[model samples]
Target: MSLARIYRGGLPSSKFIDVALGQGARLLIRRSSDRGIRGLMGRQSERRWIRMGHNLIQAGKAKRGRGMHTSGETDMQGKAKRGRGWAIALSVLAAAAVLGFGGYHLWLHRDVRVYVNGVPVDIRYRSSFGEICDEAGVVPEAGDLYSIAGNLIATGGGGPFTVSLDGVELSEAQLDAVEVEGGESFTVRDGDDAVEDSEVVERITAPRLVPAERLAAVTYVSQWGANGIDRVRVGAVSGEEILEEVVQEPRDCVLASVNPVPSDGRRLVCLTFDDGPSPYTAQVLQILEEKGACATFFVLGSNVGPWSDAIQGLEAAGCEVMSHTMNHRNHYATTSDETYRETADAFAALRDCAGVYTSVIRPPYGNWNEHCWISSRGTMSASVIWNVDSRDWELPGADAIVENCTSGIENGDIILLHDGGGDRSQDIEALPRIIDILREQGFELVTLSELMDADDRIPDEAARQYAPMPEDCAWPAQIAE
Candidate 1:
């Protein structure tokens, strides 16, 4: 390197070369003394390092090809200046970018004020209710009735919490995952003190059927069924529980079903008269005797004394006599006690007046109900109900009465006629014609007992036994007995 080029850059060429050589010798000496350098340069040649030192010397010398003030050297110096300017600009831009990003991030995550459990809380905007609660140090437990912004949220636990939001109760689904904005109020209270238990009426049980297997070929209801009642305590949490005492004890219907009627092909039909033993009783008896037919008379107990001769005549002529109650009251509307008394008196009267030991009674007006049936179970085997109506009480003329009696007369049917309720000249006139028409239709006119007796499958004792009334049936003790 020339001294002139070095002196132009303010350094002597010989000194610059001596400094380079001195630096190389110092580096080689340091490389040998330092263990890290020795390990790194163990395979490095000294000549190669010397060549690097020579290149450093060349870089220190200015490259002035034509003149000291040449355009090329000026251009090169200008380009180096521009490159440094660019590096400084790039450094300033990188620092500004970092500062801007940090500022934006700080602005984006702005703090928001929220009230949790009536305490003011400062947190980031759009924070969840759970996060707000956490920041406020308020932890909600089970059965806690808490509200957010006047909207209630209930937690499930051992109790039922009646929580409402803005005067409206919340459903079970809206109690979780609550999110809230800033400036909201919260409140909480224990539901146990606010809730009260309630009571409701409940049906205890339904009436059941009690069956009796051994009886005549008829169904008898010894006891009428009735439903029971009870009061139930309903808790807000526990639901329906703690049933109180039964309000009314349920009564089961005692249903005694006899063996099914046997189809013995005996075309027996019963002829029974209601409200009888009046003056028409003698006429009815004369008609039966003239037709050579036996019939049954449902004589009233009250009339049995005054009409004892007529009742005896009915009994002596092979006609069965049954009771029709003491007074002709509507058994359906009558109470059990009244029915029992009337039924007992009728039975006694029939037994005393005509020596008739029967177990049947025809309900007045043919309007019997379960009450009468249950009450009469003690005094009668079965209440005889008629299928064919003579319409004699209506006084629809004797021909019309005969038509009603014979139009649909089937085997094992009972024909109804009145002899004492009113004037029964029509019934007396229709009787002979009815007997003739029924006999012509191959139906043998018979009493109810006679028709029941034709079915030999029913035991004599069962037929004689009063309508299968169990001792335990739900009725008045006297009626049951």
Candidate 2:
């Protein structure tokens, strides 16, 4: 039998011992204090023996009997096995710590970003690059290239693109120029990489400028130009760009005022008679008829009842019959209700006389206040006033009436005269002479309505015609009776 050898485990000062011999090369052993046994094996050999002894111990093979007596070896073997298990546990813990730290670093610095026209975009927080571009008003189209930080990210070939966090894109490149068409926007990325790799996002575009065609022909009323002559930039939107040197002017035509004559290019004059339907109205109508002219007759409501036939004859002769109030009351001193009543009565009288409703209304003495408009509730007829006063009401002589009307008859003039306030014999006598003089001077006598109507600049021949009144001459009884 061979004696069993034993070696201590771990560190210096380890012990070695020998035990009793047994049969069949097995060792029966107990602790021995032999100092020489320690020296028998070198350090490396002792380590190897400790390893083998430990493996046997764990396998439950270390025993005293038929095999080698290995009590000393068994104790040393048990210690070595325990030490190996502790080393394995420490290695596993270190590996786990490294993996946990790496995972935390990846979570802390993650972000998605976008850019436009070299400008950083932060529209929707936590949104994908494509979603940010949509919010930034970016459109995709051909020949429009987009990049971020010198990397070409997207090539616009006139196709739609879907953006996502994981989408891959081209590298970043310097943007030399960027333009958008039809109010579209393009997406820009940090570099040519997938959306996940992008560090920043932006939208790129140029500011839109108003076209010259939009402001081409802006027509404006000049405070200094001739009456009714608006300073218009013809072809501003479509025509010429340099504004035609303000050379094109509008004809002289009356618009809203007493004599609103458009001063486009031609001269115009309006002749109006107030307090009419007296014997003078017929003479005035005859003169206008002979000269192919027209005039407005502001007839008193009472006068219409007596001279309805004559007024109708004047209307048929192309004259406009407007209201001068039932009693010619001073409108400035009248109440709101009185003004409405007076106006309504005058309208009723005129309609009774002419067998048709009249739209023209003139306040007596040109006396009107803001209340007159407000009280009527936007239904009171338009009030006509005069720009040129012939002072025919003052019994101006025939020569004076002609001079007064012609003197101020510029491009647009509404001349005022009386026809029926007491004896308008002077007006009757002066009308024919005035017509003759105006015709010779190339002045066309038009009603106030006609003069104002021409301000629209449409030719009279092209103007729409209204239906003429029936010959029955039946006034609606409710209006008159």
Candidate 3:
């Protein structure tokens, strides 16, 4: 074999002789003409090499004349003999040295080397990598790496994680064919070339409540779903980019926060303006437009024409424009004649201007007394009363109005506010916040008729229906008026 092939084995001849074959075999290398081999030998090794050369020369001469030499061919024979004799001698010695020391024992008792992830470990020689690992108190589990000599023990994460011995991948049976014996290197790694090469990122999308539409038009938020880790899965694994996707499916979670309703059910809330379609009505409508909320405008007969544009706009934009009494008359016995005209005229004005009719009316002072109820009975379908009162009429600060309206709100609650009646800046300011708060609390803002008709409830049962005469027929009516 070529000297290059011998060098490729990684164990130098001189070093092997010193470690395994002892001082006797080192003389074979020292006699070599190669500069590298001669430079490696010490003075004592070189002296021993000179003595071995003399013995080989004597042995070569004895073999030269085994047959008789002719005097005529003597000179040519002499030239050939001089060159070939020593070459044959040295070649024999070198081959023997190589074969003899290839399996020689190392008895010098030095620290053997083991490497992991480029970090060296110094240990006594062990027969196999497993033996070295056991001696060093390292035992590999399923995912850990084990290499005997250069062969990797089979370990895969149920995928293509390859372990190679000098670039040849081996199975568990193939790994057993190797031995650690002495110094050898092994590597442990998690391979994901397939994953890394692809540009897909696994991620979890947030869970959101998809409220399916219903026929009842009244339902509360049942599940306020939460955000999740990825689209199909949660956390990311190593070698995964986690940018936009995952392969594994995640558990679908159901988190309920409110009472159950039909899948398509929509909760109803009334945003009622008691006396509106005024200058301030424009501001209220603008707030509604911005918030995407609809309301019921209780239009007064007195302001309908002058405030027609604002009132018509409210009706156009999906609002309920119904009657509030004309001239703001109280529901009283003395004012019964005037109350009837005011209520009737207000309803007429709303119908004439907006081309829509309302069966709902808000009695002045929210009172349904004997005079007002009797006056409005057939003409009015139902008397709309409030469950959530902002009391902006009291000129309470906008914050107070917001709190009053938002507090204790329930499904189908009518929130009473005004776009008229007085300086309505507080009302205007509070309206948007009221809508937001109710929406955040999961209430859907709708018109009065919608609220009354929600959940398939009867209008009379859902609304604050037209009042009957007081128990005394006069006393409570007087108090209410």
Candidate 3 lDDT, tens digit per residue, 84-184?
A: 65445556656755553332323323457776445566766545555555555654443422221222334443244444544456677766665544546
Q: What digit string (tens of lDDT, one per residue) describes model 2 on residues 287-386?
A: 7888788887888888888898988897798887777878888878888788778877877787766674664566788875444544433233345677
Q: Give the candidate number with the greatest lDDT.
A: 1
Off by over 4 Å in 1: 1-262, 456-459, 462-481
Instruction: Tell me model 2's lDDT, rounded to 2 decimals.
Output: 0.51
Write down the lDDT that model 3 would get: 0.56
Kindly provide the TM-score of model 1 when superposed on the true structure, using C-alpha atoms. Answer: 0.46
Report lDDT per candidate.
Answer: 0.64, 0.51, 0.56
Query: Model 2: residues >4 Å from true position, as ranges?
Result: 1-259, 457-481
lDDT of 2 at 257: 28
For model 2, what is the error of residue 389's alpha carbon versus the real structure, in angstroms, after optimal superposition?
Answer: 0.4
Task: Name the better of 2 and 3 by lDDT.
Answer: 3
Question: Which run of 10 residues does model 2 get worst, by summed lDDT?
Answer: 216-225
Model 3 misplacement above 4 A: 1-266, 333-335, 459-481
